[model samples]
Target: MTKLISKTIALLILTSFSMLKSQSVKEILKQNGSFRKDTIFSIKSDSKETYLPVTIIKGKEKGPVFTIVAGIHGYEYPPIIAVQELLKEIEPENIKGSLIIIPIANVESFLKRVPFVNPLDQKNLNTAFPGLSNGTPTDQIAHLITKEIIPNSTIFLDIHGGDASEDLLPFVCYYNRKDTPENTKRAHELSVKLGIQYVVSYPYTLTSTEPAKYAFKEATQQGITALSIEAGKLGTVQKDNVDLIKTAVYNMLENSGNYAVKKSKTVNQKSTVLLNQQDYIRVPENGIFYSELKSGDKVKKNQILGYISDEFGNKKYDIVSQTTGIILYKVGTPPVNKGETLFCIGYNE
Candidate 1:
């Protein structure tokens, strides 16, 4: 009950974007422009701060307001690099709609070399949606994105992937929410149009931003056609993953009839595979995890995916597959904490 009250309070106390020093995104969109990119700071303290590096490209013709956000997890490097490539791929004259590109969302974590959480408050930026303005640093960043970015976005992509400790299968996923608005359908369609082959269907039960908890989910709740992509692995910037992200975004912009897309080395997969259910196996205790499986491995029901042992090397639990499916992502490293995700199985019925 206390937690519920706190959540409700946080929802109501969503402060305005007073932290922004430059013109707001909507204000920038109001003007016809060749292109404008700026860094909006989210101030934490006298000496601590983070920033959103945003690029705005308005088309000659009017269309959707597309927003691409990357680097929610600091260790996800490919998505960040992909956004830079997008800054080049998207031309103002050819774009029918405007493009808002955020190359790095968690700048502090990226700069500090933090893995999953922000170095400011040790909080996961991706999990905090519609955050409190007067709260922690992560919450402040979330609030900044929610207030400034989400409102100006008609279509959204929150790109993320494996952190420094995980192995992730490259795939794009759309929210599978019940009784969602038209945004849900459009999001799924766009995920298919991304042309990356594997499309995972993730279930989301929330309908509002306060409870959505994820960046893309918050946008989805706000009636924007939003989805996310998982690529890269173990905090390394793989060229293939970076290219995959760039090509996928280009395909989306091309399908939108807005941007001038260039054909290069991007090979579209022959067919799209629809994976269902976001089956994540999380550990319940602090232990050393052992898994030989990689992302995309097929697993049978009840099969031992891995085992968690204590510090003394005594096995405490065996991580097993609850459903038969393909692994979308898995912890590649051995460190396993309480309530940490071990594997996410993407199943098909």
Candidate 2:
């Protein structure tokens, strides 16, 4: 009996020590001044799961949380590369607030080189923000982000660029809602500090029934200061564009009080407020498309921008600008299909 009692006491002491070790591990995770990388997984459906690589760098001193996300459209390469580089270079000791970077938000789309939508559910991830848990795969991912990530962020940045089939000039976008005037101003200020050449303001409209589902739109609605930065072009990763995006991100870190870099004055950038009736020029019939006008070109109303022709060099139709504005993006490829968007024109006024 004595021997058995002694063995039981030994087992009890080991169990107590194990509990203490577990508690210590938890405490270490809760402490600041370390960088943590986690692969977060979300259930897309009954049999499918999607994963996102998240990097969290916490500073020694407590401050606000800044969230940066990229790769919403898989073919936008520069933003993804910039985010990856940021994750590698940021040091927890040099930061004041925490930095949360999601390098690839849509992993499957990125791996498959899908352009604008997720392959699993065929939904545009950008338009499915604050999504439903029981919805499609893209929707589920957005829902997980809204519930798990956005609430923790004091400021948010959604990085994007032209997809594989688009050519665009770099621009920054922010929501301008009358109800959230303070948040709107903050977002605009952040966009200016982002060091982009063009700032686009997306004002809220009551006539449209389409819900506010864009990533930055949802975040702004939640009173989070958010800006969307766009760069790169033609679905290709240019080194200069990648560096430009990286610099913008660093500028954002400095503006948000996360980094210790010297703050630069907000540069004078052109602000373009998109009119409600902006035109998306679409192809009337299938043919080969040829365009002389590139993105960022000033276009007058009813001006012929390009033409679609038959295989035998017969001109089928002429693509014209509907508004006196600038071309935000033009189709990068020569192939045309019926109803495909050929040009996106933003009004000058």
Candidate 3:
């Protein structure tokens, strides 16, 4: 009798342990301190051995579902750090909504320290949207994210930064001009909460072959409030930008009623360059670049804006502004080809 009782107890304990281990993330959502790390997709190849893991943190109360994705380019570290810190600080007990954080969306490229492009096919993961199940590896990954990861989201924040080729001033970017009022308002509110230097609003072609096919544009189409945030330069992590992103994330969560948190201090946008109807100046030839005026400088029509030169320092071509405007952006690299975008001019009127 004694042996039978001991055996029964052991069997019951083992069964309970097995049940706990095999519980799905959805089942665990019932618990107060629930947090699940799910492998959304897997990359299988000798050249790349990695998997994209998504961490889902559902708050106790019923509220909105916000999905924040980072490391789309793998080299943009500030946004990655920002989202990871948000996951760490989030208390499920106090949360009013579900928060999903995909810290390393491009795990393969992150391990290789390059942009998230397939080594075998050179296909950018971002461009593969509404993807196929049995297509290329990137397509499968994109499909998994679009189907399983993004659909349940009510709001999305896709973060990025300038890669190895360029440096980006901290900015908030949105692609809905005025067609979607709710989404545009939500994006603008988050940008204001972030207190970034620039809040740039633009539009996309809505093409499936574009690089941002699965980005904020897709989210907007699905009725998800989304914003694309660029923090700092790529490859290296900047601590100041990381802090800024963390604070902004927390503020957004609080404002969204996900947590009982303090509001971010209001920041007046006094030094902003409100750009609209901007024009791009194209380079006419391959040459070294020389700028007569800096970005944010005001100029009149027919002004000598900049020039292009050869390696021996002989001037190749002179660039003149076609309208009265402010210089918004200029390319830094030299030997720019003909028809290459050299700079952007923003008109005041």
Candidate 4:
């Protein structure tokens, strides 16, 4: 009788363990042809877990998996709004592949109205890609994105805009790889399909180091087709800019055969090749920068783009264009620091 009881107890324990495992394996977005929202925890504190919002939509028919991320800088409001609106409009039933949308990647920075870097760790999320698991809060977020989110994606899109202190034009960027010609070609096609005003290609030969540091660069290194879309300006959330970003995303979805929408005509825009660091103009000293040149303005080499003056207007430094190209973005804020970027010039190759 005792032996029989022991066998029954052992069976019950095994059954219980099986049940727990099954419960844990339940997919976050279990229903096909539907959408569900969840939280991806990047940091865990004593009291609560800091997480980013993740929306997963599984299609009825299996195809590719597209990952869309925004709000990396927190102050870029247009991309954040665009992704939020996209989550509402995409229907899983009409999609052919999975769609993962991270509307706001840095919630703490967004809530605090921080600009380029996270206030908690003072780290720029963009530069901390493929990050360390036990690093700072920003690093942990990057690590989660690189490991948990990006690995499941076949295509990746990172949306950005002019931060609180930047004024910029609409542009798209893609990584160019000589070793992976097919991936580079696909990324270029994706950039053109985005239908932005301008497209910039970052060649892999520019740096000899590992290319797994920047968000899009890291995705490209992982064999994922990735593109970065830039829109809006000065950190303001304009409805038109938001609509522009949303339309570009829809274009990609249609072009990729994931969304059952009207096919968008691919419009090829002018391409700007950034070959070196000299493409950017940096400030020489701390002062107040006054620039009349806005983004998209064409300027000649050695042209006076702006001028920096001391607080009392005593000493002044002239900012000039280093290359004969169109201004991609300029500083919107008045204050400047030594070695800070004042403007980025984009030229056709």
- Clashing residue pairs, backbone N/CA/C < 3 A, model 4: none
Residue-level lDDT tens digits of model 3 in 116-149:
4755456777777766666666666676667666
Candidate 2 per-residue lDDT over residues 54-114, each given as its tens digit: 6677787777788889998998999999888877777787788677777898887998899
Residues 244-313, model 1: lDDT tens digits: 9988887887776667655454657579889877687888799899888999889999898889999899
Q: Rank all candidate structures by their lDDT, best first, as comma-separated numbers.
A: 1, 4, 2, 3
Cα shift from native, residue 120, model 1 (Å) = 1.0
Off by over 4 Å in 1: 1-20
The backbone clash count of each candidate, in order, is 0, 0, 0, 0
The global C-alpha lDDT for each of the candidates, from Candidate 1 onward, is 0.81, 0.77, 0.68, 0.79
* Model 1 steric clash total: 0
Better of 1 and 4 by TM-score: 1
Between candidates 1 and 2, the one scoring higher on lDDT is 1
Summing lDDT over every window of 10 consecutive residues in candidate 2, give the lowest-scoring window.
20-29
Whichever of 2 and 3 has more TM-score, that candidate is 2
Candidate 2 global TM-score? 0.83
Which is the winner by TM-score between candidate 2 and candidate 4? 4
User: Model 2, 96: alpha-carbon shift in Å?
Assistant: 1.8
Model 4 clashes, total count = 0
- Give, for candidate 3, the lowest lDDT window spanning 10 residues: 17-26
